[model samples]
Target: MNVPAAPHSVQPVRLRISYRSPESLLQAFTKSVGKGGVSLPSQRPLARGTRFLFELTAEAVAHPVEVLGEVVDVRRSASGEYFLNIKYVPGRSRKGLDAALLKLFEAHRHEKSRRYPRVPVHLKAQGTTQVWSVRDLSRGGAGVELETGELPKDARLGVPVLLELQLDTGRLMLHGAAVWLTGGTSRPKTPPALGVEFGRLGLETLRALDRVLVLDGFPAGPWQAELTFGMDAVGRMP
Candidate 1:
C-alpha cells in the first residue's frame, strides 16, 4: 500500500543536493524546494518510494545540510528531462538549517552565492613523480593525503608541487605550494595529510578546474558527473 505524500510549498531559494552512493556521492540540483519536499532533476528516474539520505548545499552556508527523503513522484519534463519529487523525512535537528534559511530569505536576500564551492573529490596529486590522494578540492586548493612512506621529512613549508587531475573531460595540471601538513602513521591521525594552495594557473587549466568543480555541484550546471568507486582514477586513498 502507498501512503499519501505530505504537502509542501515552493521555496524561493534553490539548493544543490548530494546523494549517497555505494561507490561515492552523486549530485543533483533542486528545481524547487520546501520544508516538506523538493523536486530534483535527474538523468535516470529514481524508483518510487525509494528512500535515501542526501546533503543539501545552499548559498552562504558553510556546511552541507543533511536530509532524509523518499521519492514520492517521478515525472518526465517537456524537455525530456526526468524530475524526481522527494518528500522530506525528519532525521537531524533542522533548527539550525531553518534559522540559516530564514536569514537567507529575510536579511541576506541580496547576498551573492559563492562563486567557488568546495567539493569532496578524489583526485591524484603528483609532485616530482610522487603520487598522493587529493581527498577534497576547491578551485583554489585541495586537501591531499600522503602515505607514511611518501611524506618527506626534509620538505619545508611552501614547497612547490604539481597536481594532475584525471577528470572525465581530460587531464588538468596545476601548480601549488604546500601550505600546511598534518597526520602521519605515528602521528595523531591515521594517514598523513597536506594542504596544498594552488598558485596561478593557465586560462585553460583554470577553466578545466572550474568544469570539474561544476560537475561536483559547484554552482550546479548540466555536466557529465558521476561517482567513481575505485581510487585508481584518483590515486591511492585509504
Candidate 2:
C-alpha cells in the first residue's frame, strides 16, 4: 500500500493597515501568525512571548481598533530590515483597532468628497521641522504638490506631519522619521524626492489608506511600500 503525504498548510491571510500617531499615519501590509517576539533596537531585545500594546490615536482612536498583539515571529528580511510577525489576542483590543480604522475610513471618505489632496514629490533640503502638502496619495507613495510658501526643509516620508484621511482612519500621534526623497528625470545635480516606508500599521488602518487611494481616482489595486535603507547587522539604538 502507498503511504499518503501530509497535507499542505495555507498561509494566513494578510490584512493591510494604516495606523496613525499624533504626527502621521502609516500604511502597512501584513499577515498575523504565531506568538512572542524579539527586537533589534539598541541594548534591548523584548523578551520572547512578551505581549505589547499599540495605541492608535485621533481617527484611529476614534475608531474601534487598537493593535494588541503578542510577537510570534522575529527574523530579518533579506535586505536586513527586522521582520516581526504577531498574533493579536482578540477582545477589547480588537475592538479598539476596529474603531480606530473605521474613523480613519470616515475621514478618507470626507477628504475624497471634496478635492483630492496632493503630497509633495520632492524636496531640495532637510531643514528642522519640514512640511509639505500631499497632492495625491497611493498605497506605495504620494505625489506631493509642493508650494513655495509651504516648502519642507526636512521633507521626509517617515517624518511626522499632520496627516488625515476620510472614513475611519485614525490620527497619527508618535514618531515619523525620514525615509527618502523622490527622483524623477534627474538633472546632473538634483536627486529625486524622498521616499519613506512605514514599518507598522494596524490591519484596519491599512484598509483606510487603500480606500482613500481608490477614492482619489487610483484604480483599486495592490500597492507595495518601497524603501532604500537596509541594516546588515542589528544594533542597539543607544
Candidate 3:
C-alpha cells in the first residue's frame, strides 16, 4: 500500500517597511504590531481608551499603511504640546508588521556600522537660481538649509535636483534628489532643510567631492560597505 503524503505548511506573509530613521521605525512597529503605542504631538484632547486609525506614509514605500490604535495615556509638554500615547490593536496585520520591524531594525544596525560619516560644512550652493546653505556633507548625501519658502513649488520626495557648489578647487554640479525634510510644525528645533541623496557619480565628480571631503577632515578612503540593506528592506515590504 502507498503511504499518504504529508501536507505542506503555509507560510505567513511578511510586511516590508522602507528604511528611514530609527525613531520612525520604532513608531511604525509600535503602531503596526499593537504591543505598544507611539506618542503624537497634538493639541486635541483624547480620552483614555479612545480608538483611532493612523496612516503611515513614506517615500520608499509605494502605498500608505493604516494602523488601528487605542489611546493609552495623555500628557502635556512644557512647550504646551499635547501628547497621546497609543496602543495598537491586535489584527491580521500583526504578523507582517512584526516581520517588517525586525528587518528594519537589522538594517538599521548594519547602516550604523557601514554608512559614510558626515562632516560639518558651511558651503553655499545654487539650485535653479535659488541659493541654499549646505550644513553637512558625506559621500552619500548632504544636508542643506532652505530659506523661508525657498523650497520649490514642485519639489517633493524623490524629486530630481541639480545643485552647483563653489568648492575651493572649482565649481561642481551635483545631481541628486530630495530624500528627507525637516522643519515646519513637525520639527521646530530643526530649521527648514532638505536631505539630498546624490545620484551615480562620474569619475570627475567623485574625485572632486573626495578632495573636498578630505580637506574637510574626512579620512581619504572608501566606506566599508554599501547601503544595500536599507534599499533591500523596501522591496521586501508587502
Output the number of the TM-score-best candidate. Answer: 1
Model 2 segments more than 4 A misplaced = 1-47, 63-65, 68-94, 108-238
Per-residue CA lDDT of model 2 for 49-129, tens digit only, reads: 545444444443644234455556566656555445545644223454344444444565657443423331121122234
In candidate 2, how many Å is residue 29 off? Answer: 9.6
lDDT of 1 by residue, 155-194 (tens): 4467665566555555466666778877765685567777
By TM-score rank, best first, the candidates go: 1, 3, 2
**What TM-score does model 3 achieve against the real structure?**
0.40
**Regions of candidate 3 where Cα sits further than 4 Å from its true position:** 1-114, 127-130, 185-189, 216-238
- Computed on alpha carbons, the lDDT of every model, listed in order, comes to 0.52, 0.36, 0.52
**What is the alpha-carbon lDDT for the whole of candidate 2?**
0.36
lDDT of 2 at 148: 36
Write candidate 3's Cα lDDT for 1-238 as tens digits: 1111222223211223453643354344332342235666666556676665544444443334545666678788898767877665544243333443344445545565537655444554544445566666667888777665445554567766555554545556566777987775566666678887888888888888876553321221111111111333233222
The weakest ten consecutive residues by lDDT in model 1 span 220-229
Any idea what lDDT model 3 has?
0.52
Please say which candidate is ahead in TM-score: 2 or 3: 3
